[model samples]
Target: MRAFRVLSHAVLAVTALLAAAVPASAKGEDGAPTEAGTTFRTATAVKQGQKATASASAGDYLYWQFPAGAGQRPTATATVNLADVSARHGAATWRLDVFDGLRRRQPCASGEPEKKAGQQDSSVTLTCTLRTVRPWAERWSDDPLPGAYYLRLTVADGPEEDLGLPVRAEVEATAGDAGGAHAGGGELGAPLHAGAVAEPKDGWTGGWWSDRWLWTGGGALLAALAGIGGYTLTRHPHRFRSRPGAG
Candidate 1:
């Protein structure tokens, strides 16, 4: 009985520790982290066909990072939910710029244009698309490179004080069936970027793995099960013993 009680207490303590270590969801400004190599804050990862939300004021610059596979093209669309005070500032123009992993501005094949937010408009959407990711070679020149890409959003005209507006960003990457003839080399052989492999700080790196609550919960459950199994096997050792020489 004493052994059982001690084992139960150990399991409970370990479970509690695991639960405490799990990170919680961040809210408001806390959810965003400062982008590496830049002062802009980064929100949660905007997966393909999924939307991620962030808050920013007028004239505030926002940045987001997304991954692109070789022979794949990525498209990002951002919609700004302006506050009521934004209407007083008249029409507002917003710009979305796409950059490669090296922070070099890459030209978009389509959807790279300034969007105007009128006084009556409650929201404005801007989209930017990049060509297929390809290697740099003599055959294919000046093409957009693959790997990680960054999108920068800025409001050119708006009320300066009207900050804290909500913005939704949606990103999508489409992969081709096979490599094109003109697509210089093969897939991206090198690493995506230095930032891609960096460990996330406070679960707010804005990558797909930022949300670790599910993983941690699963781990805790597994640990509890293992502990129970160990205790049962040890406590019931006689059950496994051959009884009366019966096989």
Candidate 2:
């Protein structure tokens, strides 16, 4: 009995520890670590396109920009992975907007694909397969100056739900000793896709709760209720046992 009690306590302690240690690694649809890369500090969900940060329920959007000096300029390919869209993955279209260091939008290559057709899309557009893992790549000709560039990844139609689905993005930079257009020219500019691999690996360090007292008190109450129920059951085994006169 003592050994059993010890084991039960150990199991509870382990459960609490594991729950506390749940790393905030944003999970993909398959629950695997999504393509590993630097996750920007600002992440939001929206239905419509907008130039800045905001939340949304539903609507087509213009574009969202990561802050200046926030991430690498996507010189090569920037992939957006959307997960858990059983409702509208195949129906929605995505437009990838690329901006230069000066925030001047660049035009797509001639006959380049696009997400959805719009008047401004001729300048920056990438048509992606609906609801699947999509890559909006900048052809070498479309490469902008090495520096901060905005990637406006937007999608139209496809899936609709009460909550916006989680999307993960990865930007792949070119690998070589050749400094891009900005190198050796006394230029402070870096390629759009540069420095992506240098992003930190560790995530946020804060605990689950901002205030300790509330959750601690709630947990204590739950533990007390469990203990009381356990004791009551232990004291009256006959209540749960088979009746002497009835099968």
Candidate 3:
């Protein structure tokens, strides 16, 4: 019965991990965003395949929010269309930054996060491809977890004349196959995200630690010891008839 119980637990752990690995659903409003938010709190929400457009000054910061689930890789692209290129005196630089639900800046594995636009250029484009989102992550890890993500687009640098220039911006966030990269273990009870109000600490349902890992490690140690003992008992014994050799 003890062995059966252990087997059952191992199966359960594997099942949960496999279930979490399943492809994230493509479920969200299909409508495109009509506008973008200036701050994280007011960030416009967008869905996959939906293009978000906003009209803002060149130096203004635009924010957009999107949902990402485990096993999905998120990529966001932004384009700033210079309505009046002739009004610019020098080149301008644009940047695209991605953040997680915790407001932590996520490192981009690829995509030109920052791009420069020449004086005569009509538009500047920037994009960022992030790591695969995980089902659960260690408290100390900054790994991407399933939850809300935010993208910020802004003109990093440009001439003073281009500061207030009217610009049309478009942003699109899409999820791609993770290609089985950055594999991690474990699962979470819920999708953790940032909240304005702090809930009671005791309100959480799950414990902070995982006993599954501890149990598995202990089982492995016992199995190794048992194997060694069995080998000693099963192998032919060497009868040593040692004579006193005092030279």
Query: Highest TM-score: which candidate?
Result: 3
> How many residue pairs collide in each prediction?
1, 16, 0
Error of 2 at 152 (Å): 2.3
lDDT to native, each model: 0.58, 0.38, 0.77
RMSD of 2: 29.0
Which residue pairs collide in model 3, if any?
none
Over the full model, what C-alpha lDDT does candidate 2 score relative to the true structure?
0.38
Tell me, by lDDT, which candidate is best. Answer: 3
**What tens-digit string does per-residue lDDT give for candidate 3 at 28-100?**
3655665778999978877665788888898988998887766667899998899576688899889999999
Per-candidate TM vs. native?
0.56, 0.31, 0.65
Ranking the candidates on lDDT from highest down gives: 3, 1, 2
- As a whole number from 0 to 100, the lDDT of residue 213 in candidate 1 is 48
Clashing pairs for predicted structure model 1, backbone only: 57-163
Better of 2 and 3 by lDDT: 3
